[model samples]
Target: MAEFFNSISRRKFLLTAGASAGTVLLAGCLGNPPEDVGGNAAAPTTAQPVANISSEQAPETTAVKLGYVPIVEAAPLIIAKEKGFFAKYGMNDVELSKQASWGSARDNVEIGAAAGGIDGGQWQMPMAHLITEGVITKGNKPIPMYLLAQLITHGNGIAIADKWQGKGVDLKLSSALVSQVKADGKGGSRFKAAHTFPNVNQDFWMRYWLAAGGVDPDNDIDLLPVPSAQTVANMKTGTMDAFSTGDPWPYRIVKDKVGYMAALTADIWKNHPEEYLAIRADWVDKNPKATKAILKGIMEAQQWCDNFDNRQEMANILSQRQYFNIPVDILIDPLMGKYDMGNGRKIDDRTMAPLYWKDEKGSVSYPYKSHDLWFITESVRWGFLPQDYITNNAAKAKALIDKVNREDIWKEAATEAGIPAADIPTNTSRGVEEFFDGVKFDPEKPEEYLRSLKIKKANV
Candidate 1:
C-alpha cells in the first residue's frame, strides 16, 4: 500500500516559504540560482535588492478550488493534499471538490467554477477541441483549456456478461469474438456498451476495439453514453450486454460474476494516454509560477502512486469518502492484476495504471505532446470531422492539433524544475496499432485506413 505523506500543517507551509527564500538568497550570494531551483539555467550573478524580501512577501493565493471525480485514478490529486505536496509548492489553501459527473467536472473548469478539474482520459481531446473551437462558454466568452500533465494510462477495460460464456466470448484474448456475435444474430441479443461521454478515451478505445475485432461498432451494436458509476449496475440488470470502463466498474462486474473480461485496454494499446491535469489557459497565463508548482506537486504524487508496493494502500486511500468511495477489495482487483470474471475465469495480468513521471537519461518529468493523431483519424472515421478535414488542409489540421500540444509551456516549466530537456521524449510515432487479429494502425495514412474499413461512416 502507498504511504500517505504527512498532512500539511500551518507551520510546515511557513517553513517551506522560509526555505525557498533562503535558497534564493544563497543562490544570489553564489551568483547563481540553486541547481535544484532552476536546473539548467545559468546561476544569476546580479543580486537584486528584492533578494532580501521576507518569506511573507511571497505570493500567496487562497481558496484555490479544484474539481475531481471520486475514482481510483484520481489518487494523485488526493495524495498531493494528504501528503502536503501542494503545501511544499506554495498552494497552502486548496479545496478539492468532488464533482457530480464528468459534464459537471468539465463545466466547472470551463466556467471557472474551479481552478482545474480531473476527468477520464477520453475527455481530454474533446476538452481541447472545445477550448480551441470556442465551444466552452465562460461569462459569455470562450474559455481556453490546457493540459498540464498526464495523470495515468491504461486504467480502463471491456466487460461482457456471464451468459456470453457458452456463446464463446473471452476477454483474455482479442480473437474473433465480435464476429461470432454478429453470426449469432439474436436480434434483441444485440450487445450494448456504455460510455460516459463521446470523444473521450472510452469512446475511442471501445470504437477501436470493436473495429479491430471486425465488428462495426456503429452498426453491429448499440452504443450508449451512460455514467461510469452506473455501468456495472446497468450490466447486472441486463441493460448492457457489454461495456468498456475504468477500474472499479470492471472489477465490480467481475467480482459479482456479472461479466467476464472481454479485453483489457492496455493489452489493446500499450502505454495509451489517459487522464490529464487540465486548467484554463487564461489561468495558466495569469499564474505561471503557481501553475508550475501545481504540476510539480501532482507529478510527485503520481510517482508515489506508480510504485507497485503502494497499490493496496493507494486503493485504500481512494476508497475513502473523499475519494473513490468504494470497497478497497473492489478497487484493488484490477489495480493488482487479479481478474475474477465470475464464470470460472481468473487471470492475473498487469493492468496499466497512472504513469505520471518519465525517467529518461537520468532526468524525470511529465510526457508532453503525447496525444496522438489517431484520435483525429478516429474522429474522421466516426464523422466527427469532415473527410476532407485532414487531406484538403493538412497544415491547418496540424495547427489545430498543435494548439493543444502545450510543449512550449511544459518545456519552460520543466526547465525551471531542473529537468534536463534530453530526458523528455521528443518524437511522436504512429502506425496501424496491431490488434490480436494482426491488423495495424497507420496514422500517416488515415485515408487508406478508412478505405479499408468494411462499415460506412455515419452521416454527421
Candidate 2:
C-alpha cells in the first residue's frame, strides 16, 4: 500500500480568502488560496522595475483580474499573487479568479478584448495561438496573445478505469488493450478517452499515446472534452473509460480504486511544454511595466514551486477550497515525486514531476518558439490550423508563431528577476526534442516532423 494516501483525509472544497489589504478570498472553487499558497513567505528582492520604473511607481492598470482553472498547473500564477510578487511590482489590487472551464477561461480573455475584463493569466498555449487567428472568439476579432512563462511541463497522466487494470496500459499503452476496449463498446457507441481540450497539448499528447497503442483516436476511440475537475468523477461513473489530464485528478482516480494511470505523459515526452501564462498582446503593449512585473513575479514562483521542500506546502495551499480542493495527500504525492500508477505499480520519478527551472538553459519556463511550432504542427495535424500553414505558406505560419511566442518578454523578466543569463535560452529553439518512440522534433525541420506522423491530417 502506498502509505502516503493513508495519511490524507477526504475533504470538500471551500473558498476562503485571508483578511488583509493584499489578500481577498471569494466563494466556490477559486477566489484565492490561503496566505501561504497565495504568495511566497518572502517576496523576491531582485524584481527591478521596467524602464527605471521605481518600486514606488504604480502599475499602468492598478487593478487586474486574471483567470485560471482549478489545477496544480495554475500554481505559478497563484504563488505570484499570494507571494506579493504582484504587489511588489506595483500591482496594488490583483484579483485571481478560478474559471469554471476552458471555454469560460477563453471567453474571459475575449472579455479582455474590450480592455477591461481580464488582462491575462494562465491559459492553453494553443488557445493563445487560435485566439490570435480568431478561431475561438466571440466577435471574430483576433486577440493577439503572448506567452510570458510556462507553468508546468509533463505533470499529467492518462488514466484508465480499473476494469482495464492489467491490460498493459500503465506507463506504456498496449495495442491489445485498445483492441479489447474497442470491441467492448456496444452498438455504435465509441470508446471514449477524454482530454481537457481539443487542439491543445493534452489532446495531441493523448492522441499520440492512444495511437502508440494502435488505437486511432478519431475512429477507434472518441476523444471527448471533459473539464479537468470532472474527469475523475465521470470516470468513476464510467462516462469515460480513460482520461488525460493534469496531475492530482489522475491520482484521484487511483485513490478511488476506479482507475489507474496507464501512461505517464512525462515519460512519453520528457520536459515537453505543458501550460503557460499567456497575456493578451495589446495588454502587453499597454501595460509593459505591469506585464513585466507579472512575468518576473510568476517566474520566481515557478522556481519556488520546483523546490522539493515546497511540495507539501503547495499541496496544502491547493487543498484549500479556493484552489484544487482535494485531499492534501492526493495533491502532494505527485508533487513529492511519488506516483501510485493505480495498476499496482509505484514509481519514484523526478522527470515525471512538474518540471520548473532546470538550471537556466534547461529552464522549463522559457517560452520556446519551437514549442509553439510543435503546437502549430500538432494543431494543423488535427486540422486545428490551416493545412497551408504547414506546407507552402510556412513563413506565414512562422510569422503567426512569432506574433504569439514572446521570448523577449521572458528573457527580460528573467533578467529583472536576477535569474542568471545562463538560465535563459540564447535562441528560441530548444533543438530536437526526442520522445520515447525515438522520433525527434527538429524545430528547424518541423515540416519533416509533420510528415512523419502516421495518423495526422498532414499525413493524410
Candidate 3:
C-alpha cells in the first residue's frame, strides 16, 4: 500500500484568480485547499511562470471548457489547471470538467463549447481521428477534431476478475487454457469483457491481448463498452470477467481486492501511445494562438508530471473529491511504476510506469502521425474500419491522418516553449513499432503489417 500525503484536507473544486494580476484569472473549477498545495515536501518550490510567451502570443480567448475522464491520463490537464500552468500561458479561464464517461466526452465534443459541451480535453486512441471522419459521432455527422498531444503512456492494463486467479489467463494464455475459456463461454455465458468505450484505446488493448493469446476476441468473447466505474461494480458481482482501463481504477481493483491485473500495457507494448489532448477543429482554427497556448501549458505540465518526485503530490491533487474521487494511496504505486497485481505477480519497475513527457523511445507528449496509422490499422484488423482504409488504399488513410494529426502545431508549441531541438522529433512517424506478440508495424508500409496478421477481418 502507498503512503498518504501528510496532511490532506477534504475539499471541493474552487475557482480563483491567477497567480499574477493584469486581468488574468485561474479560471479553472478546481480544488485548492491550502493543505493540498505544492509538490513534494522534500523539494517544495513556488510554481514558476512560463517564460517567452510574449504579448504577441497571447490567446484570442482565455476561457475554454474541456472535458476529461478521471483516469491518470488526464493528470497533465488537472496538473496544468491546479498548478497554474494553463494560466501561466494565457489560458487563464480554462475549465476542467470531470466527464461522466468517454461517451459523454464524445457527445460533449460534438456540441462543442458554445453549446453546453466541451471543446475537447483527454481522449482515447484514434477517437480524435474517428470523430474527424464522423465514424463514431452522433448520426455520423462528422465533427472534426485535431489531435494535439498524447497525454501519457503505460498507465493502463487488462484486469481479470479474481475468479480467474491462477487460471492461466495472464499476459500469454496457454492453448489448453484458451480452449477452457472458449468452452466456459458456451451456452450464452460467453466470457464477457469490457472497455470504457468501444473501438478505441481500451477496446483495442483488450482485443489485442485476447487475440495475441489465440482467443478470437470477436467470436470467442462478448466484448463491449461499459463505463469504468460500472465495470468495477460488475466485476464484483461476477457479471464481468475482465476490463481494460487506466489507473487508478485498476489500482482500486487491487486495493479493494476485486480483481487482478493480467498484464500492464507496458508489458504488452512498452511506451505505447495512450490517450491524447485534442480540441474541436473549429475552436483551434478560430483561436490558433489559444490552441498553442493550451498546448504549451500542457507541455509544461507533462514535463512536471514525468518527475517521480512530484508523483506523490500529483496523486494527492488528483484524489480530491472533484477529480478521481478515490483515496490517494491507490495512486502512489502506479504513479511510481509499482504494482501489487493482486495475484502472485508484482511489478516495481519505474521504467514500466506511466510516462508523460519523455520515455525510452522519445517524447510521450508529441503526437506522431505514424501512431495514428497504427490505431487505424488496428481498427481495420478488428473490422472497426474497412480494409480499404489502410490496406488497399493507403494514401486515403494518410490523408485523413495528415489532416487530423496537428503535429505542425505541436512543433510550433515546442519551439515557442523552448523545448530542446533534440526533444522535438523531425519526422511524423516514430519509425517501426513492435508489439509483444512479435508484430511489427512500419509506417512506410502499413499494408504489409496488416498482411502479417494471422487473425484479422481485413481482406489482405
Candidate 3 has a TM-score of 0.90
Residues 395-451, model 2: lDDT tens digits:
767888888888897887788768888788898888898887778888787788877
**How accurate locally, in lDDT, is each candidate?**
0.57, 0.70, 0.81
lDDT of 1 at 200: 59
Best candidate per TM-score, number? 3
In candidate 2, which residue pairs clash? 14-321, 17-25, 38-82, 39-82, 39-83, 40-83, 170-262, 171-262, 360-423
Q: Taking the tens digit of each residue's C-alpha lDDT, what string does model 1 give over 334-419?
A: 77667666667566755444344542112223434424466666667786655565574344456665766565566655565556
Candidate 2, residue 429: how far the Cα is off, in Å: 0.2
Model 1 lDDT vs. the true structure? 0.57
What TM-score would candidate 1 get against the native?
0.76
What's each prediction's TM-score?
Answer: 0.76, 0.85, 0.90
Of candidate 1, the 10-residue stretch with the lowest lDDT total is 17-26
Residue 365 lDDT, candidate 2, scale 0-100 = 88
